[model samples]
Target: MNRNIKFDNLRGFSMILIVMGHFIGTTHFTQTYFDFAYTLIYLFDLPLLIFISGYFSKDNPESSIKAFRTIFIPYLIFNTFWIIFIYLTKGYVPADMYLVPGFGLWYLLSLYLWRAFLPTATKIKHIFVISFILAMLIGTVNIDPNFLSISRTLCYFPIFLFGFYFKNLEEKFTIKRSYALLILIPLLIGATLLYLPFNSTILILKYAYASLHMGNLKGMVLRLLFILISMIIIILLNNIMPSKKTFLTKIGKNSMSVYILQFYFVFTIPDIMNYLGFNYVFNSTFLCIFYVIIATALVCFILSRDKVNKIMDILIIRVTKILMKKTTP
Candidate 1:
């Protein structure tokens, strides 16, 4: 398959925001600037990630099995590690956290499901409508938390479908970089203005919440709004970013390793810094900027290493070969 550098750039952009957003979320201080920054990052991070995932999705048995090996195996392995770490450190085991996806591991599970569902989903006419209806209907019900990951899987199915269709959409309506700035300026300002009243509500909706006491209809309405807004941002981002190889492109190329492994530092580093009595160091917004830069660089450096990628490749290959054998004639 030909490499789509724009998609890689998009993933690189989203992955950085994901890491930064996680760091900011776990930090102790809260500022209006931080809140606004966090909201902007939150708005498109997952949607962009999922959209790119769908854009690259291939429908075939080999690709399906590869997705299982690459995403699901690592998800299970890392989740087990997370559970053990929590038990050893916190002195209590949240069994549910392991059995279900805790932290950001849900995306990996969701990606596997989306790829698996694609064959059947794409064959139907009006899939966009069907998927949206299913997502909205699913939003109305209170799914068990143990099954929350699957709820998100269902909730964002439409976005995935849209990404799949974006392949067609891009051919007809390519937004040039010259128009990107013009379009983005108004959208960002409007989104910011709207965010004042709806910040927390938007956050709740972004997570595909079953209910936030807004009742089912309103909750569904908010989610739909979020979906629309996220798509617009995704489009703008695709237009704005350079479609060439760059530092981020390298990071984006190895985004899976960074995505799966970065949480280690995201969750733990603050504690480590605090334990080292570096609270004063992390207090300033300037310092936080520095931290974000360093943290992102460190994550990219570690995950992009040859040894680490090789190890991951070995495990993914081993698992896929076994599973493929079982299913093959």
Candidate 2:
């Protein structure tokens, strides 16, 4: 209610994590490092995002409507553009256009679906939670792609609901010492799970496989524990390091534009470097990291500038406003 410093900070943090996860994912790395980082990304990246999304849901129908315009419209527009880009560049749209490497707009598609259903979802929280857990159970056991979709939908719904519920709770529940403890407990649990070894023979390649192999009881427990850890870290960070009313907040506010546009840099910048002969200049691991760091910072800084982002902000708002008016009664 009080502008939710925690939620805002968490949103910004999650966006950065998602971006970094993609960067790590796309770069050529040793198997051990990739596997570890990929596993962590799998465990918390999306759940944190969905939780932040839910946190902002609150009780406002208008906000939900705006979220639809902001998330869904851009998702469709960007997806279309990417489809065309792929066709022109590669002569065909890639089969996994939805899974745009380093962009992760597929999450946007999934988020859009959840936002559209939030109205009905908010009304039946327990039913949604139960249904989601059951679906995850079924998906894990059967190993069906359709079931995987259902499992993800179900898993993230509770996060959205938790966000909605927390928005309300902020009014009634003050941040106390106990609240901090509640956050820490789950983090510790998650840390233990990550460190502890399980039977290598039983481990699965896919995330769903790992969950299924863990068995319903352990899988649900681990997943719930991880979600709790993520939520707690978000809350704790918000309480400790609230966003200052500064440039980062402005960037965070316009994060979607930054998000949508960053893909061009992520996908094409390597090629651009190759063309410019920077790739040959920096071929080693240290140089590669330095190059990525410089490139990413340059992209973020350029996009963070007022002139470019202001124009984008104006265009997006005008377009979204028109769509909102048309969609609304």
- In the range 208-281, model 2's lDDT, one tens digit per residue, is 64543566667666566555555566555445445456434555555666666777767777777778877653
How many clashes in candidate 2?
2
* Candidate 2 local lDDT, residue 264: 71
* Model 2 CA deviation exceeding 4 Å by range: 1-6, 31-45, 58-68, 94-103, 131-135, 141-151, 171-207, 210-219, 274-283, 313-329
| Error at 49, model 1, angstroms | 0.9
Error of 2 at 168 (Å): 2.4
Q: Which ten residues in a row have the lowest lDDT in candidate 1?
A: 201-210
User: In angstroms, how far off is 53's CA in candidate 1?
Assistant: 0.5
Which numbered prediction scores highest in TM-score against the true structure?
1
Error of 1 at 251 (Å): 0.6
TM-score of every model?
0.89, 0.73
| Highest lDDT against the true fold, candidate | 1
Candidate 1: Cα lDDT at 233: 81
> How many clashes in each structure?
0, 2
RMSD of each: 2.6, 5.0
